[model samples]
Target: MELQKGAFYLIEDIDPEKIFTAEDFSDEQRMIESMVADFTQNEIIPNLEEIDHQKEGLSRSLLAKAGELGLLSADVPEEYEGGEMGKISSAIITENISAGGSFSVSFSAHTGIGSLPIVLFGTEEQKKRYLPDLATGRKIAAYALTEPMAGSDALAAKTKAVLTEDGKYYVLNGEKIFITNASFADVFVVYAKIDGEKFTAFIVDRDTPGFSIGPEEKKLGIKGSSTCSLIFEDAKVPVENLLGEIGKGHVIAFNILNIGRYKLGLGSVGLSKSAISYATKYALERQQFGIPIAKFGMIQNKLAQMAAKTYASESLIYRLVGNIEEALHGKVDGREIGAAIEEYAVECSISKVHCSESLAYVTDEAVQIYGGYGYTQEFPAERMYRDARINRIFEGTNEVNRLIIPATLLRLGMKGQLPLLQAAQDLAGQLISLQVKTSSGGEVPLEVEFDMLNRAKKLFLLIGGTAAQKYMKKLAKEQEIIEIMANMCIEIYAMESALLRAKKALAKDAASAETKIELAMAYIYDAFPKLENWAKQAIAYMFESNEEVRTNLSIAKRLSKYQPINIIDIRQKIAKKVLEAGKYVV
Candidate 1:
């Protein structure tokens, strides 16, 4: 469906059956979350200002403390010094600790993208030598993939590894930029060009003769997290240090990035919820117009919008995580895990973009809610605003991510891999063909709307398919853009699925329902118009010519059907729940 510019979608129509609830969280996972949350509040929050001002390495003591609590080992196998929990558990911990600010970046990098290479690509010996120590936080791990010229074109790294005449070791020479955890890293998973044509990864130690770290960088946000350049001057890495076979670095990089995307989304959710909570409480306490600002319709509208965004993010994350977990059951080995992760690259990319964008929107509105105080350092919203900016830029710029999503969807469609969408569409068609009566005894005809939706879906498929075909032929230059379009399509598809799910739920329990159902109805009512607008925009951007002002104006006029709800009020309601829970409960 198409969505209009500046129009808001309601989520009240979402099915409780499909919605992720607290029951989905395992007791052990919940316990871990509690520990991380308490630890962050007790340890990190008080010291955040000191750490940021000092611009020092995170105190080694804190790392050791996290290790002791098993926070550093959630994703590692039980055979090592790890808790052996799955990605969902790791996500929960990451989200909770994000409230700790910059420290969360450091902690997540240490446990996730940093350590994953060893677990996925390392030899048994490598795992034995490093996983235990790394898991226990006795040794810090770093991943070096981005080079001066190879930011998003990760495969074009200039770092070279050459074999010695005796074949005893490979000599490495290269530099890596924006390497997180570089300052105190004990080991690095380095990717380098091999034989001038292939990229390979290696494990390098910090104390190696030719290994050195550049000075720490001053960043826009996440200051407490160390970011620096790594220089490898003729560093000798043993052949055994190779992470995987030659030319296979792409596998390791892509898989780890996929997982990273999910983790990043989880972190965004936490920060967004925190921002909403802070703004809501401030609104209720800060009086304006002779009452709490939240009592005003405008403020309530913002609150509602915030809550709706948060709900969408939360729902998508849990759904994707559950799907990944189900797909990965009994598949614990590296190759199996990598394959599973690669299969969901599209979903991961979409989640990353959606959650990051959602956080950005929520934080912006939050700052607005706080009025003058939100811009001042005296409040957390300002800091959150700064911190939230990076989520869209890093891991892969949202622009690049967008291309990945639509391109991946196109590929999946061509291969008939996305059966769910087809099934959903078929069901929608059946429902549309069969007329149904509303609870008010009114006959509702959805056939026309369904036809429009079907046409929109076809348009998306065609545009996405054409883009993929053109881009893949010139992949070296257009891969990033391809990813952006791919992501956009995936998001469109997901929103459509959510709307469908919401409709089915309402239809099933038209007579007997509770408050959740009411909320679902409100959400669907609000969401449908916006979804339609988005679809129209997507179609216009793809098929409409530059001179097609008539088409553009028509789409714009279609968007005028719904008045803008008071987002401030909606955000306040969301904020109250967030404040009451002290975090994002959903």
Candidate 2:
């Protein structure tokens, strides 16, 4: 197999000119972002109480309103009366609309997992029948994959379907729980097993006979989005409604998740920006002692960290989206697009894990900055705190995604798709020669960080190669070590992305990139130590020999040692910028 051509394996030679960053978004994308931001602030935020209360028809009405603006159609094709815009446009909509909170959940449910199955795996007839209405939000869509017994183990679905005597329909029987958009969804992309063996996907209409929606589940977060179970008792779905091929349901299910994960990460970035703004404004107004609380070092620390992580998350999201778009360029066919998205599954998982965790941190700190007010329902910080918690559990739990990062990388390496073993062998030779170059000594802006990224990758390769050699085929069972290495990989990606984005901005105009440069530096100065510790842990775990472990730890230390930038100055400067701007401007 050829090398996996993505961020994970394609780490050696990335051109800043070619790498996409948020600063590189097209004019049309900026327009779309502004429009969605207006809608979110003007329409959605003001109606939060009503939406959260599950007001009758309010959520659906808002979704229809978005449809009129073509917000619901970004990922659809022109022939189907859809927007036909690129994925970046679609991502912008998802990112900015997140300020709407729960309503964003409803909107994404309708446009993403709910409708993407048909958009990507549906037959031509299926696409024609569903895409037009779905694109316009005339028919809301939902995905039914989580059954009562199969949350993580989705393929072990108890939902059974069998063709009827005439073979025109398949009778289904099962329950799907925790479904988004369930209360108002007009169509559903459901998964069921045939003959208790062959798992398959089906497109079921809301009014299908014997199909019933369960009572709405009272949720902890995203309260405005509908969450209910679906009961399919002898429900008859047309044979033509089947999505993709029988026994290939996992293909559609996982591929849809690849896109979902990245979009979710982008949504996290949007919300983090909002949280920073909310917290910063509150701190400026709230008094402490003789001056505003914003003057406090602790508050400044939180603000700086939030903005830094958000910057990193935003950078990685765009980078990942750019890769998907490049792979998907000119591919109009649904299956082809699905295949393209599946190619970057590892990067998608990284985005999901890193961004979601970043949002969790930002929201938690926002509440901290808000102090007592943050805990109250009167402020958005409390709500944001609640809302951000579900993302880790959503898409796939961070644990599952963490395992996926390494598992997929190693799997590809073993299958010859990624030259992991070969690269590890080369690095091993370097370890013997102690030829690991730690510092670049480059004096240019962010060149230190560029050097830091290279060292981080070398550390990952070092720890990973040792682990693979020690465990061979059984590395998967060492969950602790694998997760530690996964965190290493995640940090490497975050550092590289932030570095690239800031560099791209500097290349355009160095004077204008101070905040971006500081953000990248702040994040790297803060994150590299964590990476170093993880590398140390992996080195310690995989090696029983003290001398070998000592050797690897020394290499890790050399790789980690760099001229530390003014971290205090960096964070304080970032915090002051956000405080002055009242949001994450850079």
Candidate 3:
């Protein structure tokens, strides 16, 4: 699973090693997945409207019940009375709960963003004080970093904190907007500039003096989750509550979000899976011209497209999890864990942007499949459509994440963390001559896709090198090229991930891997051309001469050349499987 250390991202060696996938889950993990799915479907789905209305404080009660079941403690250390399950199990919990709608949003905030700060950055005293209660659902937790003056620019927050004269407390004064779980959370991980200079984090209690939550906000989605503003006027926080270190709040704030972004991808995939289920069931039952709509080729095409995209998204997410877990090597300490996860921050952002966009596409098609009912609130497709829109905005906007992908890689190159520039230079000489690893997977499937994927990497390097050379120090400011290169990087990761999973399925001797193979082929068929077009755009932007543009496009055309797979036939196979199961089978 050595997927080219850090931001180099499988650019060089084609190591189709034994990567992790959903099929690789242990028996315990499968049971946990089953248990979570049961809880979400039986308890949360049936009571969704009541929960959506926040009736009788039902959302809070349900969260507490989840805590009692130890679902909320997957990432917490065992010393604090937590389940201490690893990343795979936590991903299962995150993925399975997504169909519960806004309750999943609330659940994710509490378990992931809210409580994880303490688990990952808090000191010994802080963990002992907060983890037990949070782990047991005896208390709720929230994270507040977004301020009115700052949205994406989080480090520029206007919130201020001044040390008390007695040195016992820090007085906080400012406002934080869009605070999730604000209405019921007992603890908050808040960030403020110390003495209006040093940015820092503090664990502020709900009972702190002058600490108040504003009225609930009206939002388009995730309505069941409480979103509000935090007003702090001379609010007193104990000095012991200081998280991480002074002037290093970015370490905690930014690093925690790395985990959040990956989890967002996992949740998006889960919700996409749900959308498939909803659409498949509807297509099967709904009749048109006295026949099931599932019989229509158009509807089947949509279902197949949805399943293939989701397969790619799911593949990339679990592949990322395997890499991160291997990097951590089972460490539970605070800084060590944060730093390890931080190492793969680029991959996480890729997961965030790609999967969220995939969810948006999946949900939209789901609504279209439902015809008139999808627009009305009477069907789940409408709610799913509304809910899916927010993921592209969460964990940082897709635009921001896209910029981060290339920018981070460039930074790593400058710092000599990864030999990105060197690889680009070396690849330039070998672009056309670079041979695909036919013997790589050892008599396995997707050999054609394997070649396309290898060529895709070279194509990315050629354009990336051109962009870097042309823009030089000003590459980050070249937002358009930056985003184009980022999308290329994302597609490269996605193509490899799906290919690896298909190989893994056959490697594991699955009873049936036809659909997995078809999914990989179908996705690669669609993604490779998009990669070439993106490369052509970047080339045209970088070079003004038409000859240079033509030359580059010619190179890309050769690199992207492949016998197009029969996507319609493959999609029909995928749709047959999905419609028969009435869910995302592969």
Supply the global lDDT for candidate 3: 0.89
TM-score for candidate 3, residues paired by index: 0.97
Against the reference, the lDDT scores of all candidates come to 0.70, 0.88, 0.89
Q: Write the per-residue lDDT of candidate 1 for residues 1-586, one digit (tens) a residue.
A: 1121110011112233543333458788788878888998898889888766644545556777899989899888888888888878877888888888888888888898899899877788998999999999899888888999989889889999999999988889989999988888898999998876789888999987788899989988887788899998998888888897898889899999988898898899888878877887887788986988866767766766666666566656766676676667788577887887787687687788888988999899989989999999898888899889999977888877776765555455556765433533453344335332223223442323323334434434433444444455564355544543454355443454343443444455643322222233334345445544554554454454666545643543443233344434434554455445544433
Least accurate 10 contiguous residues by lDDT in model 3: 435-444
- List model 2 lDDT by residue over 253-349, tens digit each: 9999888899999999999999999999999999989899999998999899999999999998998888888888878676787778878998999
Q: Which residue window of length 10 is worst by lDDT in model 1?
A: 3-12
Off by over 4 Å in 1: 1-22, 54-57, 414-459, 462-490, 493-586
Q: Which stretches of candidate 3 lie over 4 Å from their true place?
A: 1-4, 432-444
**TM-scores of the candidates in the order shown:** 0.83, 0.97, 0.97
